[model samples]
Every structure is written in structure tokens, then in C-alpha cells.
Target: MMKVLLPVDGSEPSKNAILKGIEEGLLEGKEIHIITVVPGIVPVEGYILSPHVDDTNQQLAEETLTDAKALLADYPNVVAVTRKGDPGTEILHYASEIGADLIIMGHRGLGTFSKIFLGSVSSRVLNHSECSVYIVKS
Candidate 1:
């Protein structure tokens, strides 16, 4: 069976990507893995913030995965996972671990300036993934 990795971040584009995949029948009879990554917390001035922040991030990640799974409820071969780290790095790692054949993700279509300032996760995965990547633009 084909293994498809879907990385979502609770964005409209990500939701659209899932919908498009279903509409195109790309996920049928495939092993679908849906993942959401929460960035690792960083300390400020050598001091860490309250633990509530971390809890909140983790909760959000779980919620995102839950939402994605809900979208794919009709698909039986679907797995939802959550990770903590850089979104692009975690996505690549998960895909490699699962030996995914294809990755379907969303493109936020950030402006050049914003793209430069805030690195694009989709671009990173596309450029570095060992498997084919299908981008659903917003």
C-alpha cells in the first residue's frame, strides 16, 4: 500500500490540502499518516517560562491532529501523530521514518519578504524530502 504523509498546522491551507486529497481520491486505500508539530519551547534570558505554555502547545497539537483525523474519518488506514520540534524538521523525520511514498501538504503562499523572514516549511520539505511532494496552494 502507498504511504502518504500529511502534515497539518491547523491552517486553512492545510485543511484544504486534506480536502483536495480526498476529492482527488489520493488517500483511498492508502496508509495515511497525519501529523502536527509544535515548536520546542525556548528559554528567555536563561529562564524558562511557565509550564502552562508548553501544556497549551501540546494541547493545540493534539487538537490539530484530532481535527485532521476527523476530516479523514472515513479512511480506515489512517494514523494521527503529534510531535514537538521544528515543523519542517519533524515532518521530514516522520516521513523518513515511515518511508512515505508521497507527502501532501499546503503552501501558505507567503510573500517574498515574509518567506525570507519566516522560513517556509513546505519549501523545506519539498527541497529535502526523499519522496515526491504534492503541494496544495492556498
Candidate 2:
């Protein structure tokens, strides 16, 4: 069975990616790992003074993952994962860690500056991933 990584961010484009993957039979007899990256309240190496910020980030991550789980529950092969870090790097790392054959994700995430900074998570994955990458747009 093939393994496909579907990274979502609770965005319409990400939802489109999930739907597209299912419609294309990309998940047929395969493992579908759904990921949501929560950029931490502070960078990994940075100091965070506000516990409130940390709590908020955690809550948001849980809510986002819960929604993602509900959306993907109909697919027998799907699994949900939530992490904190750089979205593109973490997504790509998880795909490699899982030995995924394909990485399917949205064209862009929740950030606006991503387009100018790195284009998108999809772009970064396409450039850095060793596996095949499929980016869906809404």
C-alpha cells in the first residue's frame, strides 16, 4: 500500500487538497497521514514570556486537529498529526520519517507573507522533498 502525507492548516485550500486526494483515489488501499503544523508561540530557540500565548497556541492546535480529524474520519486510511514548528520543514520531515511515497498538500497555508518568503509550503516541499509531491489549489 502506498503512503501519502496530506498536510492541512484548516484552510480552504487545504480542504481542497484532501478532497482532491480522495477523489483521485490517492488514498485507495493506502495510508493517508494528515498533518497540521502550529507555529509555536515562540520559535523553538526563543524565549516566551507569556504563558497565555503558549496556552492559546495549544488550544488552537487541538481545535484545528479536531476539525481535521472530523473531516478525514470518513476515510479509513487517514490519520491526523499535529506538531509545532516550521510548517514546511516539519511536514517534509514527517513524510520522510514515515517513508511516504507521496506528499499531498495545499498550494498555500494561513500565512500571507509565505508567498513572498518561500512561495508556500507546497513549494518548499516540492523543492526539498525526496518523494513525489502533489499540491492542490482551491
Best by TM-score: 1
Estimate TM-scores for all models: 0.89, 0.84
Instruction: Report the lDDT tens digits of candidate 2 across residue range 69-99.
Output: 7767777877778888988889888988999
What C-alpha lDDT, on a 0 to 100 scale, does residue 41 get in candidate 1? 85
Model 1 pairs whose backbones collide: none
Provide the RMSD of all predictions against the true structure, rounded to 1 decimal.
2.8, 2.9
Poorest 10 consecutive residues by lDDT, candidate 2: 113-122
Please give the CA lDDT of all the candidate structures. 0.87, 0.79
- With candidate 2 superimposed using the best TM-score fit, by how many Å does residue 37's alpha carbon deviate from the native? 1.4
Query: Would you give me the overall lDDT of model 2?
Result: 0.79
